[model samples]
Target: MDSLILNILTPVAIFLFIALFTLFAVYAERKIAGFVQDRLGPMETGKYGLLQTFADILKLLQKEFISPSASDKILFALAPILIFVAVFVGYSVIPWGPNLIPSNTHTGLFFIMAVVSIDAIGILMAGWGSNNKYSLLGSIRAIAQMISYELPVGLSLIAAVMITQTLNLNEIAFNQGLLSSKEIYFLGFWKVNEIGGIFGWNIFQAPHLMVSYAIFFIASLAECNRAPFDIPEAESELIGGFHTEYGGIRFAFLFLAEYAMMFLVAMLGVVIFLGAWNSPLPNIGPAKLADWTTGPVWGVFWTLIKSLFIVAVQIWIRWTLPRFRADQLMTLCWKILIPLAFVCMAISGLWRILIMI
Candidate 1:
């Protein structure tokens, strides 16, 4: 009974968290853009525009739900929910802190990758249902981009999985903490199992993973349909892309899903490459900074900090970089990222073999 209640409450809590996070993230991105463009972003809504997102949410809630006259009503209405659910369900396996995962599946990483891919189907549905040429083109671009990038994302994750030898995300996170059961080494030389910090992280344990992390990060940016890789939603060209015909609450869900995807991918990167919730500061001599700062609560703190930092970088890149032409985007994924990802995988295999020898 308790377990059943917990399951019910967990999703409710996560839903609330996502809603609140979207509010903060939207406001934060506006401020960040303001800083980048040398303009005040939202000073009028509520001191520093703190309430701007809230105001926008209320407005969206009040707006009339509008659909194209000839649109497929059923699919058009269902697409946003599908898109949002695809991204939302991926959160189940995320390790928020020590034993804090909502669902600690043995195949956690694999599950997330699989479920998140469903967003492509949702996008395609939205486009096709809308019966808009622009929306269809956008969905086509999104599908191709997502499918192409999935290769590098999967290969890079496989590289990390080879090093960890486990598919459990909780275990992967634990392996980077001080209490890890397995011995950790710094650069495959000095043992750092006792030193638990940045040294115990996968990238440091196997330096080649730095390349893998880079590939993962770039592939994730594309997966999230973020800028440079955001041709699917190019405002100037597609006028809001696959969601062109959506309005009111349906559009809000799509918008929420995009930001949620940003956070989701960022958190995944943190868990896989950035030590999850583990402290970066190592225990040295009597300092014991890592020991002092690691616990269930601290775990949540560190995970959020690292993940948010990545999200900030994503936002920065959005404003700083130009959107990639569709051809350039596909070429980067197929020619560049996929090749590097393969090399990373090969190197991981060799590293594991050498360690055993």
Candidate 2:
């Protein structure tokens, strides 16, 4: 009975959380944009426009549904649902903290990477189904960008898996905390205990994995179709891109899915590279407070803090840089990121083998 209750409630809780988080994220993006541009944002809807996002949600719900007359009605309708569901379901394999994961599978990492990639298909459907030339162009751009960058994303992760030798995200998180057996050494000079939690994280594991993390972060930005790399939705060219034909709640789903994907990739970076839910330090000095403050509950809190920081960086980059040209986008992925990822993986693998010998 307890297990069944947990199984039933987890997805419900995550769904509600994603919905609410998307509202705040939208508000945050607007405020951040205003700050960047030297203006105040949305002051009238509520204090600092706190209610603005909620108001927007209500307005969307009440808005009349409009569909492109030329669109394939079935695929047009199904697109938003698939995109939203793909992002939402990817959360199932992520372990929030001890016993907080919805599903504890050995192949959690592979499962997440696979599930998140499904959004590409939905995106293609949205573009092709809409029957707009611009929409088709945007969808083609999306497929190309996703496929190009996904190679680096997976390869970067391979470096970490080589070190940890497991795909279970919970184990990945556990190995970063002070209680785990993984140890860090300083060029064979000094040994850092697991209590040196941040030092034990994969990003700091070796020179190669550090490069891997850098590649992973960049690829993830492209994966989520955010910022300078967001060529698929280049407003100057494609209007609203693949989602141009959608309105009302259909548009809302697509919008929410984008933000949710941002959050999801940010969390994945934290888990695979930045130490997941573990505190940045072991029980030492001021960091000793983490010993008490860094349990399962605190794990969730830390994870959110890290993930939100990444999101903030994404927003900052979005406002700071110009969008990449299509050729530049492809060149960066294939010529630069993919090769760098391969070198990083090879170096990390060699380091692991050397240490064992």
lDDT (C-alpha, whole model) for all candidates: 0.92, 0.86
Candidate 2 lDDT over 135-227, as tens digits, reads 999999999999999999999999888887899998887776565665555332346553555766667766677788889989999999987
Models 1 onward score TM values of 0.98, 0.96
Native-referenced Cα lDDT, model 2:
0.86
Off by over 4 Å in 1: none
Q: Taking the tens digit of each residue's C-alpha lDDT, what string does model 1 give over 276-339?
A: 9999999999999999989999999999999999999999998889999988998898899998
Score candidate 1 by TM-score against the native.
0.98
Which pairs clash inside model 2?
none
State in Å the error of residue 249, model 1: 0.8
